[model samples]
Target chain A: MAELTCQQCQELAAELALDVLPGRDRAEALAHLDGCAGCRETVAALTATADRLVELLPGAEPSAGFEQRVMTALAPPPPPRARRWRVAVAAAGLAIVLATGGWMLGRASHDLPQPETDAQADVRTVMFAPLTTENRQIGEAYVYPGQPSWVYLALDIDNDTDVPSSTVRCELVRRDGSTVPVGTVPIAKGYRGWGGPAAVDRETLATARLINSNGHTVATAHFRHTRRR
Target chain B: MRGVHLRRRPPERLPDDMLLAGLGAGDAQLALAFVRRFQRTVFGVALAVVGDSGLAEDIAQQAFERAWRHAGLYDPRRGSVQTWLTSIVRHLAVDAVRVRRPAPVDPQDLMSLIATITDTPERRVLAGETSTELRTALAALPPEQARAVVMAAVHGMTAVEIADLEGIPVGTAKSRIRAAMAKLHAALPTPRADHG
Candidate 1:
């Protein structure tokens, strides 16, 4: 409750004159200035200085064609209506691939079996106990490549489901028919299921599967690696 | 001849909002309007700060080009369009001043101009007397302190910015400004002299 020193008042004076103090600090400085004579004097001096500076350095206006240049950089592309049907057709094709999980296998090729209808393979859907009282929903699958023959599998959650607090196991099947259990991840209420990537060569992994702690199949997908064109 | 006639029109009289909207729509005419509107103010502030017509012209051109590229970011909520635009010009002019290191008195021409046209006889007499006293007091200060005070008092730079530009500590900059103010306060004519 002691009087604030001149230095503290000075700092506040400078900051207030510049309009740079945070809200709470500004309020406190103003409250202090209300009763402090020295601080009030300091504020007047600073204001006078600011006014004089403004007078001394009157501003110049900008040049011609300035807005045109700025507008040129900021202008949006022409409306999509000009090419509406073409864009719509492309979007519809992308929607089909996403809905059937056909694109998932294409991305996870190394973990999928090469079937006769390889391009048309559908991901196997397994129903687990309702993830919530509401219902179960499927999420997108993601595959991330890592060094020295490892790939991460991430299944994005599609709904706010109350998943049971438990662990889920994943298995990877090799092209030569050998199988190996991978890591487990917790399936808490808000958790997204991920298996720590299994260390298997690209030539070996042909299929991947997930099962809950109760031994019920939750999801399955095949993988096939394609040669680059 | 057509181009010359078009060039002579004042930019501020143009419909700036329409041009700004056009700019938002990605049209080139907005840039043309923007250049015409602010060119003079930018050049004027630059000349005032740098005190050299040539440097002012160059700085004004650079500042305008930058404002053009960044125009889309302007928000009407904070300040008027002119205020925001002129703030850019002011900062760019200050930069020119820092870089050129021109003699401080050279730029005092603008101040001298302000001193010349007195609105009233009394004001004229007072401004003339104070201007002489102010100059004498300013000349007595150390060059660094004088520059710091002048930049702060004349250009509205914060003490921190002055310190950064001058390569000194904030405390030193603040003290310099305070000392310069004290010197000027002492040199100011007594209140009795005004009554006489």
Candidate 2:
């Protein structure tokens, strides 16, 4: 195909900026943009320009419970091991309590901040869905905004897995498909593992996953980092 | 004692940008503040496009969720939080309209549109000077040009849809939108690097 001239690129710039370019034209414009820095800048400025029209219409308030609904929709699914883990953890606590014969019934030292409250407190939840059926592990990462490095991750393993703590690994997946090892996630309270406030920043982090010593992924989930300020 | 002045304390509330930054960081209080700050604009634009309070509510909800999820991606250099968010709500609202084929644009809607533009509290508090310039520039456009652009923008109309609405040729509709964009850009001031 012949190289597109600046004029052709400019003509399509306005339409593309408005997101109204026909598919064929859009494809052609993108092809040109791959090689044209000037056109890219023009498109960006024009897009900003087109977006300004939004300010003209008056602001209106939506009905209540809308935020609640959105948050609920975005909530991470219950961990795969939750059902079994709940029973095992409770039973184990009871057994330890009965044997020791000293501690209070509800007092276990492994108490982490409940994520429901964490979410209510405005900590962003970075949910990772299972990448495959074999990898039944799910993850919910909590981080205070602007402090991406200070991530608190909860990894839920499948009820059947028995990987030793010495071999477990957790990683932060990035948009470019690279992985950064954050730390190990041990089997805490039977199939539930927690790790991090890892030194990893949220800038490129896309997914958080668990891996076994065998180099196989145990569970993986994706994250959407929309706020970049 | 009469001549002594007390030092002023820092204001307790975060500015819009800081609140958004906090929301990006997953601060719940700031998230609520951000919603309180921009919900009206988000919902209003959605309402104008979708023409139903309920559907607009859905669109607005999705828009805010998107803002929260993608807060880290927002660039202050590009536009203010208000303008960037306005774009998101407008696109979602327009998409909602496309999907449902909601009520056709009534002439009275334009009168109401004018009223909203004139009376919005957000326009004064949230919108920066360029937004004001944009409003004036849009007003200065020939009525047909302004209408054509609005139809394309808030309604997500194509050149053909705009042509059908105005009883004009597709090329004419396209040029009117293009011309309006040009005029608006010319009339507005350059975006400030410092403002969010």
Candidate 3:
């Protein structure tokens, strides 16, 4: 991973705050954060904002029996009882199952005390952006973050409207509105095709578009979160 | 006079923190109250990310169980019980999808979340927030940027995930997230000179 300068660290602070900066970059940024106060403060403020974003999603009701199910799941095990003759007879049959695969052992494990689940457990986030032409959905982008985190694109461009190319250039628009070439993907028989790894860069991207062999934009997908207030 | 009148309030009507305290102490009624109070919000959060009602239900249950177990450790300074529980369920739901289905949700599907949800006083209470400064700042942002920031902030998605999900390059994803967050952070109230 390239070592991040203070400027770069500050630039990626939001990713770090949101825990989405990709692997080595994340490690590099955290190292920079340890030595840099301004960056830490910047990241902290973003973290606060990120935390507040949860309020935007509205709550909805679960199934009717959910409450009973939750309470029943939380119930403690019944006390182990002293055996009467009939109980002892039933227990002997149960002992056979316990000895074979140890079903009772599994049940016993739950009886033990458990450590409190951390409120701040590590969570992986996924994003899906649709590809469109003239406001018509044509395909989608599937993304996951990790070491060299990945993106896969599935495009089914309608040639009748999209001016499909034998091959299409996948171009991404940057934060500065400059366009970067990812690569070209071929259409074997028709416009329907898919390409992967999609060359997700380290810089922030604004939009993605497909350019035809004629250098004309055919389909574009603008990634926007339109969560209403 | 306020104190005299308050004593008549039902256990179900107790304040959030008090209910949380009761939950931590394993008070059956209070625990039930806590579950009832936040179940919808918790279930909604779970369902939003996973997009599966059954999986969402399991996640919601686990979230409530976690809340019941960890209520004592909760910090009011961090957020209200509702927000905290939402956070828990959101993480759980994300984790569930990562394990059950790694594919990204449709951008339209996510956009529909805002459109489909209605604003209500109940939602505000569930959010455990009255001050709209942060939300206002988020709203002030361009639609694309706000969505990027929300995907990162609420869903715990990274720039790579956003890049992949948006079918954009990683740089563009990072830039959108950074720019959005910076704008939102700028909107936060500045603290006093007592800064640590």
Candidate 4:
């Protein structure tokens, strides 16, 4: 039989000591050890070494309350019946519009005043400006105006890294008595897409506030008419 | 007759996949049974890797919980249940080690203390003479090498996994394991002592 190289024997020794070799490799290594006294001695030493080290490990058992604690942590909370009913009613109402094809897909486009030059117009392009609080930058608030009665408020968030995918509530508050919900912005890419047509009663036309699903004011804009026409 | 006898006989032990299947069925009793069977060994491995009793307990519980949750993912073809569970505990321990900064105890002092404490006849006898010698040898090794051996033997991690966890090259991890093993081999009692 050819002698096993030191490296080959060492690798086998490590594998045998760790008991990590696959069945075939284990068989081959054992075969080699059977005829080779040196290799056999090496394997025996390694095994003894492993066996001894195994005993020094701490033998502390899990506490008696472990299972109960784990179960409690994993247990699902009871359903909120009242809340579910409200949601069911709201869903039923939505189902009607969806069923009847009453879903509105209206789009209103308004061109802002042209800049003095093409460069200025290009520079005047709207981009999300981040809202900063407590020295932590939270999100970018979208700023654009479409009509006097309506404001387009958009927040580009990376939902993947930012928001937890829980139910989020969005609301638009006008300075006047009128308040309207644009709709819940599905958090995508960490940003909340909000702002659609909101009917601002003439009485409450002083200012508008965009509140996110968390009820925090993400952005606010003052009412100033660019053209009275 | 021999072939007939072999065909009729039940396998000596149930496979890990079957055990895990029993666990996943919400068989709390089977789960308890499994825990009872492996708890000491698993805890021992965790304790060896982290070198802390409290951390070992946490690691054991977390490893079991993870096993419970992902039991369905266990494949019998890959390895035994013992190996799989060991791998999980070791991976978690390695991660814990990386995230945790050890207190400023001098490695040499700690090693010396371990050597002295484990050197007693009673301790040696309790662990078996071979184990005592092994522990002493391990304690005498460079901290990194000793850590590598402990992580492999107790936690059941591959050299690659240990290197990745420790942020060292694979070759470095292998060398540490080999060096630690060599030191342990040299430290064993003479063959005469073993026979007697």
The prediction achieving the highest TM-score against the true structure is 2
Error of 2 at A169 (Å): 32
Instruction: State the C-alpha lDDT per candidate.
Output: 0.48, 0.60, 0.60, 0.50
Interface RMSD of each: 23.6, 18.9, 23.4, 26.0
Q: Measured against the native two-chain assembly using Cα atoms, what DockQ does each of the candidate structures obtain, in the order listed?
A: 0.06, 0.16, 0.13, 0.08
DockQ of 1: 0.06
Q: Candidate 2's residue-wise lDDT over A1-229, tens digit each? A: 5667778878767677777666677788889988888888777677777777767777666677766665564444534433433533343343333233211101111122222222222223333333322433343454432322344443344334443444457777778987777787664323232435454444576777668778877556666654421
Instruction: Summarize candidate 1's per-residue lDDT along A1-229 as a digit string, tens digits.
Output: 5455556766666545433333566677777787777777666555433333333334455445543443443343443444433543443443343334321222122223322121111111110111211123232122222121222343334234434455667676678888777777554433233424345544455666667767876665566464312
Candidate 4 local Cα displacement, residue B10, angstroms: 17
Looking at model 4, give its docking quality level. Answer: incorrect
Q: Which stretches of candidate 3 lie over 4 Å from their true place?
A: A1-6, A31-38, A78-229, B1-9, B116-131, B190-196
Candidate 4 ranges with C-alpha deviation above 4 Å: A1-58, A70-229, B1-17, B51-54, B76-78, B102-148, B151-176, B181-196
Per candidate, the number of residue pairs that clash is: 33, 23, 15, 10
Place model 2 in a CAPRI quality band.
incorrect
Chain A alone, TM-score for each of the models?
0.34, 0.37, 0.38, 0.28
Name the candidate, 3 or 4, with the larger DockQ value. Answer: 3
